[model samples]
Target: MAEYAEITYTVEDRIATITLNRPQARNGYTVRMSDELADAFGRADSDEEVRVVVFTGAGDHFCVGADLSQGGFDFDGEPDGPWQEPAGRCAKRIFLMNKPVIAALRGAAVGAGITITLSADYRLAATDARFGFVFTRRGIFPEGASAWFLPRLVGMGTALDWMISGRLFGAEEARAAGLVQRVYEPDELLGKAYELAREIAASTAPVSVAVTRQLLYRMSGLDSPLPVHELDSKLIAGLPAHADSVEGVVSFFEKRPPKFTLEVGKALPAYLPWLDS
Candidate 1:
């Protein structure tokens, strides 16, 4: 079993709980964590018994974005290059998944953390939860599609406020700003998110839910951007199969870490519309 450095996933009662497993660093993501999450989500998506997903941090914080310990990616080295695979898989895969995802946010949800929360179908934050877009402060442009997704969720003005300022907001402020769906006491957050997830799982029809998700994402793309889902998924599926996807599935059933193959992205079909019948 390949041990994951920063994520843990378990399935029960048709729901998967994906925990950001790095409390020592406030659940900060590394390239490793990003890959691990994408692989975990792939397993949950393929499992017929797993209909709902609840994302939460292992300890106090949900996530504080990328690991400062590891520093940031060298995006300048290549255009449309090496970094794109892991980066896209982490954020884009979560955003594009057909299954319902509910974020149970506690402590800090900064940078990519906040972006992922925005991508979720529902977000339940602790009263003390902290949210920020720390990219600008860190001297980099937002890479996690916040430039595209945030405005759609909260409109242009508010998106400008967050993205440009990189301001951190408390949970109440986050809820008021429309960053979170609801706020609960810190202790109540997990239960409330789980409750909401169960409600959604019980109420939504499977195939219909998937189709609706597809439509929502498709419609959210900008006029200038490519039809993102078709292109993104084509790229993901074309990758040399990560050992993690198989290990992740087997591990969920047996409770183990995934041994993964090295990353590789191969050619795939063009990004195009689903043909109307």
Candidate 2:
């Protein structure tokens, strides 16, 4: 329930929704908004009651890119020091979160707008949504670690084409390129996102979801299967003793939905993120 200047954070059922709130500005990205977003994600990660997160924007636009009202040199004003870029901070937080995140995208999502959602688990876009990589046209490169995430989400060829051209494209192209999972009518986007979120919250084990999210994202970068095999061995060997595993088995035999009690904040496995030998 923390207050934010450029965003709204609220929780209902087991889903935490983070809404970009500057409708007049077209939900433009700003340094303050990045910090607030990171904080909100941290809050959701630590709250045992929160099982999923939904991200969206207010008004007609998801985001139109950086707020340039401060002038053309706004980005250059960052104090000279080794520091994480504003957009990267928020994106990194989303990447590391234990809870699943779904983005309900509509209207325009350009530059930082689209890049920020690259780390989300799923993106449900409105059929009318427009997307642009726009950074090349602005005389800057992609930020928000899109250089790394974009290639992984969409193939390197598509990533390079979109980013190099920096042209606007429609949601259908986005879905074909694998940037979005599904497309819905403008008014139905959020409702569909929430419905998916509720299903995950109600049916999945929190600890298993947390571990699976990290495993998939983190392991995708590995060059060999040995690392994955090692991690899988450890997880399979240890998971049999967990309460969630017992309940899952019992429920399958009893033909009933499982009520998982293992909490992500308190019950996550200690050997997660598998260290190399």
Candidate 3:
């Protein structure tokens, strides 16, 4: 329940919804907003009650990219570090989060706006949502690690086409290009997002979900299946002793929903594959 100037954070039914609140500016990206977003993701990751996160904008537009109201000098600022950009900060936080994240995108999602959501596990867009990687159009390069994430999500060919062209594309095109998983009417977007979140929260084990998320994202960068074999062998060996694994099996046999007591905050395995040196 933290108060944020550019966003709203609320948790309900084990789902945390982080909303971009600057609707008048089309939820324009700004330094402060990025910082708040990173903080919100951290909050969601640590809170045991939060099983999933749904990201969306307050009014109509999801985001129209950076706040260019200050003109060309908007990009001029002291470095947080050598290469750390505001959008990257938020996107990295989302990438590292243990809980699942679903972006319910509507209206304009351009430049950093669309790039940031590339790290999300799923993107459910409204039929009217328009996405553009407008960095080249604005005379700058892409940020938010889109170069790394975009190609991985949509393949190098599609990513190159979109980033290089900087043209606006609708939700259907986005889905076809692998950027979006599903599209809904504007009014139904949030409902569909929440439904997905609820389904995950109701059926899955928190620790298992967290570990699986990391394994899928992190293992993709590996050079071979040998590493995956080693990791899964380690994971499966230890999982059978955990309460969640027991409950998962018993609930399946009993034909009832699982009541997973293990929390991501406390129940995560100590030796994660990514944590290994």
Candidate 4:
């Protein structure tokens, strides 16, 4: 129910679209913008009707890093209170969401623009999109846990090249390095994003997608497969009794789109190890 000024949120056909709305400023990054983004994502996460999220910006450029119009980044901090980096506020919220997120980027998606989308489930970039890990160039450290995420998305060597050098790269290079899922024409970007989101919304179970997203992000980092196997066994053992699981099987054999009824807000397994985390 929170109102947002820096972004806009709308849902259609079960997919929530969260758009950065400062087109006049090229969706420049600011603390207020980050706060709104986190709030909007939380709203989407809690809405049971929202099955997937399509994140994007409303302008020729997605985001042009931080707003330096005042000759420095627009930021806020309290010496007497706790604070977190701007980009991390959005990235972490998206990471915790029960639904999948697809980021559609075009034009300049440099600095915070690219970093903020690191935790998104899928990143679809426009042919003209440009990306950068320009923190070092700005004399700032990684803001969105990119140090941990970038290396995992690409390899350590590629991460080092992007993060350390702080150079802007094109969409094709980003796709080649696996930083983005795919590249499309600027005119086709959002269509592609929505297409993929619709496919997921129509075919996948909400609870299953939530569980799979969480398990993959959390367990993939463990030192051993033994623990993952233990958790996987537990997850699979309960599947037969889950309503969505039953529907999945029936629809698969019937060769039709599934009508999964499970909702992430209520149907997630109580035994999930990281439920509290």
Candidate 5:
């Protein structure tokens, strides 16, 4: 029931679509848009009927980065203020969501635009999509925790190269460097994203996907597999009693689609340490 002025949020067929609405401005990034995006992400994450989130823009462009209409940034906030950088809030919200997020990008996805989508589970871009870590060029630091997420996705060397150079790259380069998972024509981009989202919604157990996502992001960078092994043991031990486990097994044996009834908000195991954090 939330109302958004800078973005449109709608849920249908288990997918929540969040579109940046400032098309005339080429979906320019703004503080209002950032907060609205965070709110929409939280709403979809909490909605049991929304198993996936599609992040996209309404017009030809996804986002052309900050609205620079006022000439430049105004940095007059009190040092002791509780204010958070708006873009970081959006990134953090998306990072913590239990439901999967797929960002569909076309045209210009530069500066904050590109950085924000780096946290999504999947980035599907149109062939015309152009991306840049343009903060250095703009005389500002990168937002959306790009330093951390970029290196993990594209490697430290490529991250350093693109970030330091502040150069724009096309979708093919983005895919080759691992920044995006797929590329398609602009017209076909959203269709493919929805197709992949549908596949996930139909085949995967919601609670299981949530746990596995957290495990991969939270545990994969460890120096050794010992901790992961221990956590995996704990997770595997409880699977027999899990409702989704039963449904998955029965559906597989019967050669039918799984009717996994476990809701992500409720069915995540209590032993997950990060849930409390």
Candidate 6:
């Protein structure tokens, strides 16, 4: 299985790095790479020592999307009913992970690559990075929540413009539109990403960071800050009823950092704050 010649994972200094190792194919993603990525992110999410994840492709290209040569382009597989389809299952772990994920883009992020970058908590691109959502050109719709995440990041007008036109854009344009949080030289992309991840990992408690990430994800879908805050208030109120919140508050007043217990299993609160009244 290791002879597939794609996707690798390693950890250093609390950062789990998942590299798309298919440079020969411009780091195109195949089913093997998808499974590897799911496993890597799953481990990172469960490992307390691993506080952050960095995702990037090996060689010059970040990822040029799926390798159609591999016959995995249709996102097909066994279906355990409609709710358990392969396409959704493939990218569900990426969206559901509580750990912060940073994508380091040093080259082209096209098609599926664009979807992966959009899924990340923060995208750090090289100054020369190229991005394109070419799904329209291929006669396919955007997959892996790009339809939702892209518009949320860049707003409806810009998102529809890119999706419809499939125009290629550069780093500065991405930054201006808030698609990328930061840009650096090609050589500095990984280092800058690591610096940011380390800064956050070292200063923030892991549990708190994860919970804050959950809150942010929850709030991102709201229509306005008011609904977001309303949802946040309810969620925070529920959290205080848990033991972790009590410890967090007591430790705050005692001038000591809080060490929270991780009890967040598959229980995610359903808070739809986007309904217009």
Q: Which candidate is the best by lDDT?
A: 4
lDDT of each: 0.73, 0.91, 0.90, 0.92, 0.91, 0.77
Runs of candidate 6 with Cα error greater than 4 angstroms are: 1-5, 70-90, 222-277
lDDT of 4 by residue, 106-126 (tens): 999988998999999999999
Who wins the TM-score comparison?
4
**Candidates ranked by TM-score:** 4, 5, 3, 2, 6, 1
lDDT of 4 at 91: 93
lDDT of 6 by residue, 93-173 (tens): 767777889999978888877786676889999998999988788887787677878888999998998899988999999
**Model 2 score (lDDT):** 0.91
Model 5, global lDDT: 0.91
- Cα distance off (Å), candidate 6, residue 46: 0.9
Per-residue lDDT for 17 in model 1?
94
Model 2 shows how many backbone clashes?
0
What are the RMSDs of all candidates, in order? 10.8, 2.0, 1.6, 1.2, 1.5, 4.6
Backbone clashes under 3 angstroms, per model: 0, 0, 0, 0, 0, 0
TM-score of each: 0.75, 0.95, 0.96, 0.97, 0.96, 0.80
Model 5, residue 141: distance off in Å is 1.0
Residue-by-residue lDDT tens digits, candidate 3, 20-114: 99999999999889889999999999899999999999899999988988874254376666846878988999999889999999999998889
> Once model 1 is optimally superposed onto the true structure by TM-score, how far is the C-alpha of residue 83 displaced, in angstroms?
2.4
Which residue runs does candidate 4 get wrong by more than 4 Å? 77-80
Q: Is candidate 2 or candidate 4 better by TM-score?
A: 4
Q: Which tens-of-lDDT digit does each residue in 1-277 have in candidate 5?
A: 3589999999899999999999999999888898899989999998899999999999999999888888876343564767777678788898898999999999999988888888899999999999999988878898888898999999999999999999999999999999999999999999999999999999999999999888988998999999999989999999889999999999999999999998887888888879877
27-107: candidate 1 lDDT, tens digit per residue: 876667777888888777777777789988988888888776745553334556555634455667677676889889988
lDDT agreement of model 6 with the native: 0.77
